[model samples]
Target: MLTLIQLILLLFWTSVGSAGAEKLYHRRDRSDVRIVHANQARVITDKHAAEVFLSRYGFIKPVNWEEAQFEGSASAFTDDFLEDFGDAVLEGSSQHPLRNPAWDGKDPDGASQSFISALEEFQRVSGLPVTGVFDGATKEAMNKPRCGVPDKEVDRNAAVDPESSSSASDTVNETDANRTATNSSVSADSFEDDAYHLNDTDGFDLKGHISNNTSVNGSHDGDMGNTSASTHQSQAGHRRKHHLATLISKNRQRRDVSERGYVAFSKRLLKWRLIGEGYSSQLTVEEQRYIFRLAFRMWSEVSPLEFVEDMRSPLEDVDIRLGFGTGRHLGCNQRFDGTGQEFAHAWFLGDIHFDDDEHFTAPNTGSGISLLKVAVHEIGHVLGLPHIYRSGSIMQPSYLPQESSFEMGWMDRKAIQHLYGGCNGRFSTVFDWIRKEKTPYGEVVVRFNTYFMRDGWYWLYENRNNRTRYGDPVTLQIGWHGLPKDGVDAYVHVWSRKRDTVYFFKGTRFWRYDSENDRVFTLDPEGRRYPRPISEGFPGVIGPIDTAFYDRRDSHIYFFKNALVYAFNVGANALARGFPKSIREVFPAVRRGDHPDGHIDAAYFSYTHGAVFLLKGSRFWRVAGSRERRRRLPLPRNGLLPHEEVGEQWFDICNVHPTALKLKR
Candidate 1:
């Protein structure tokens, strides 16, 4: 007497089988499996099918021990910490390495040995150079998520009803029917009490989860936005969060650090609503909104996640909400000290409440608390980021102000990217994990700027002084060192024995910078100084230049705009007679109409190869004198650039070395 819905649930459970031996129906080829429901076949992956079954039965996805395994080798320093920092941070646990590995769980000796064995297995499984020791690489591998399971604390086992005995034929042979189910099923409604429960008396009880519990001293009358070096050093002395976590034997039940609680959204696009009114009268509503918008944008700059505002929705219905509150408001017992005490607090994938009593200031300057800075930190919490121990990180528990600059630190980027990866099919690990190939030439450092060909962004880096140092990032609007702010359309570095300069071109205008002198001067068509229109700089040249480079052998500059290549003598600053020839006419390998855009994006002279490379999209053509010699650079066997496959945006070339061009490491 089972209903149609009950029959479907039963069929799904039959397919999933028992807990310990969870069935993974998706093949390595990523093809969907076909299942018959009411005599109709439908295609779905095992994970999706499991999600559907859970939704139908109103049960949370089960917590499976197998999902806790770390997948790949950890190369990053943070990766090492996360991998080995299992459950020692749990509130009630004492299983840190400094302390005893034994916790409440049984098998003390066995657990200790198992940990070492597990570390070895992790190294081997992660494809690390196994030394059976807790090496750097092995530690990083432990931090990454595996088995499609996130780092968040998810309780309960998945709910899938076993099918009727008559439906035995529907079960697949690959599934283990005899395996044991570790956890019993619980109803979804009951999960609410242990989840996010808001009490009328006590404020919001977020299942007792406090992502980062960094202690904040009493309210400071002085400005909290000072980013002075002395202040920074003082703040560094403050207690920071540890990477410790609690672990209980093979069960591996764990918790993150006190000030480290990160939650992830089930969906990519999170919709949010603002519940309460303005927290402080120091700034206008528009100003506050602008501050919040900037905060959200700061995070979006690095992560694949996105947030949208849903103005016309209930706070509870929205994915997340923000508003101001006072003591006892919304059951929040933690009262705000009217002065510049606790700025605000937020829950994981939940509401953000500002202390309405705190004196707030929109600008970073001023004695009052910087509302913008606090907003940025609070938004980090709303976006599932816990309080990070790193000082430069936006997720850091305390705020250190930089006069005006607002950018996510390297740790922040790495952390978020680790969680959700980057957008636009980026973050490939193909080439990054491979061992470096020895360079034919001596070792050289490649300054791989991410904004290689980006329209408006640019940066400078120098590594000769033992350590890498670079100027702050700037956009086209704020030209650096006398360069035009309009944006650099094309650029090149001329390594001449007499004079070396980095040239930047925008529209018909160009500028040359002397790295030695730290001076920039406008350049005419010829290498001479003084600003002039492109037409005047290079006689007979029309339209914007896509790219330009000076050949050391010929001592002439070649300007590439669209399909046309215009050559100009450096000394004369005048075009060669009958110039402006089509690239297809000069280089036979370049098809006449190959690119729909009919333009060469970039070109550079390679001294190692003794040739010039003309870049178009993902492919490039290597060419020498005239129509005599030309050949397209070989595309990778896998048909992806090293940088592209390794999830990097820009290809790095160092010292004009051929080995560097090959990108072995």
Candidate 2:
């Protein structure tokens, strides 16, 4: 129905709902790009465009107010906003651009937690605090609103249809708040038509709905690449879309500034795309700063993040940190050329650094390759970008300045979209009615929440295995490990903001179940559980057993040896037990851990930055991403490698004689 979605006209005047709520649809004529008379086809309404555009930016659109009410909570900023944000949160969760809440749309409290988590996630990704509160920075990041300006007037234009039909206003039901708009005065002149569409003579009549002086049937226009539509809910109460919509009492105030059009224009930009400096290329201290700032602005976009916390209305919120520093390690920042092994690094809580010595040449010495392309790469690590297998890209551990970070290939774009989130700035509008509620902080309805491990939960590696685990990420650690009780087994635990806790499979002691008979066997020489049983009693199974992961989120149980993963639904019953059983779920050959194939890894539970890991040559690498907190540290010399590949892959964490890992947060 949205085939010609690009031809949208924002904030146009139109009538409300018609009888053809279903069964009919809108179609478009490509030749009808010219402007038409007031009686011509209705132009793409702003309401519809706003709905479609917002969803493109990783949001959702609600079918109606009632549906929005069902999905959100008192914590929701707005029903309309929540519905749309819900879609983005659910769909883009795997990449974790936003916080990941449980997928199931139940538990109002849990839903609130998810919202809190999403806000924190946005903060973390954008280099803000992990604190679950919507602080000033958080507000700035969430301030994107769907608005626009045109140079001319708007008129109905064209149509094409799918099997059924619907209208923009068909679903645009007025909530108690919006009901005021019906009797309210809108600056119709505020709708600019000339900027995007011209007042040309190419006019044509709409499907003759003019005689009825009726509004266009938006339901009829559904076809083509309508990604925004995909994220919209079919019905107000449908689970597919969870928008935040609300009806406000006429007490709503209006803006006073008449020259605020430019501000409004800027706000609309973020809805189109998330423009930013592409990946970074290596450069010196001053150079890095300049480039980073550019990249920072590029990523800012026009719209601020938006939410309707009960504390506030569905207003735009902008939250993101903008600054730059060389991630130069004290060793690396020796203020000299090529003396250290590392360049720069960024921590999750917002810390950045660069090498002081690595400067542009003399003469009119200008932009030089950065000393710490490694640092930018490291920051990428914190922001959720994984290392590239190739030896280039800023994300690649070994790539140097010669290989530009700015020139991203198609693969790079795809990878970013896959990791961070869809780059397109599609906008969705929802009325999140953030009302005064009970408990701590009455007005701010916290929809999401988060928590990182406390400092000292882990200690730096004192030996070999510990050495092979650093680079980007706040920290990395093997929190859990053990031999299979039924047989011989080995598990490697890992943690990080980049990936979080994971258990890699190593080896079984020496016992398992007989595949054919489902019988237990003592395979170990001792013939005990070591010679382990082939199968289990009712609760246990044998052979290449997986592990039992613990967490309120989507905890998992997996077998490293067999490369299998099992997901558990974990009902109320398992909530008490430290570990939930695999009631149901399966994954095979799904290798997971702090990383799938990182040269180094850190902390079982890192705070913000500085993960420690041993590399190929037995060298340790301190990887970190900077945020509002965190200070930059130099990379230790030759800390990236271990004597050999497995010289000590899984650090002897728990088995060590003394301490394990700690955070510098």
- How many residue pairs of model 2 clash at the backbone? 197
Q: For all the candidates, what are their Cα RMSDs to the real structure?
A: 24.6, 29.6
How well does each candidate superpose onto the true structure, as a TM-score?
A: 0.41, 0.18
Cα lDDT tens digits for candidate 2, 1-665: 54444334321212223333342212243321333342222222222232222232212211111122222333334446566443333221232211223222222343244344444433443456788564566554443211111111112111122111123223323233222111111111221333211111122332332112111122222353556555463442332222222211110111111132211111212111111222223344345444443333222211121111021322222111222223312221112113232243332212234433333221122345443233334434323233343323444333444333343333333343332233121111001111223566565442211111112122233232222123111221333123232221222222223332222222322323332232334442334443323233102324434333222223323222233333322232122333222211221111222222221121111222223222222222222223211342342221222122222232212211111112110
TM-score computed on alpha carbons, candidate 2: 0.18
TM-score of 1: 0.41
Give Cα-based local distance difference scores for all models. Answer: 0.44, 0.27
Task: For residues 1-665, write the lDDT of model 1, one tens digit per residue.
Answer: 99999999999898778545633343454232323342121222222232332322212222221212211112213533543333222342233221332322233444233344434433443456856554456444442311111112222112111222112212211134344422222211112223221110112222322211112232233454535643543333221111111111111212111112222454566666555453445667666666665565555545655666677776545766667655434443233333333457665455566776656666656466666667767776555454443446566443543335555666666555554555342110011000123356866433222223334434332222211122222343443467664456666555456745466677776666554344466543466875456776567666477777777667777777777778787667788877888765544443444432347666655433344655665555555444233232442211211111213422221111111111110
| Ten-residue stretch with the least lDDT total in model 1 | 426-435
Off by over 4 Å in 2: 1-289, 297-338, 360-368, 371-379, 404-406, 425-665
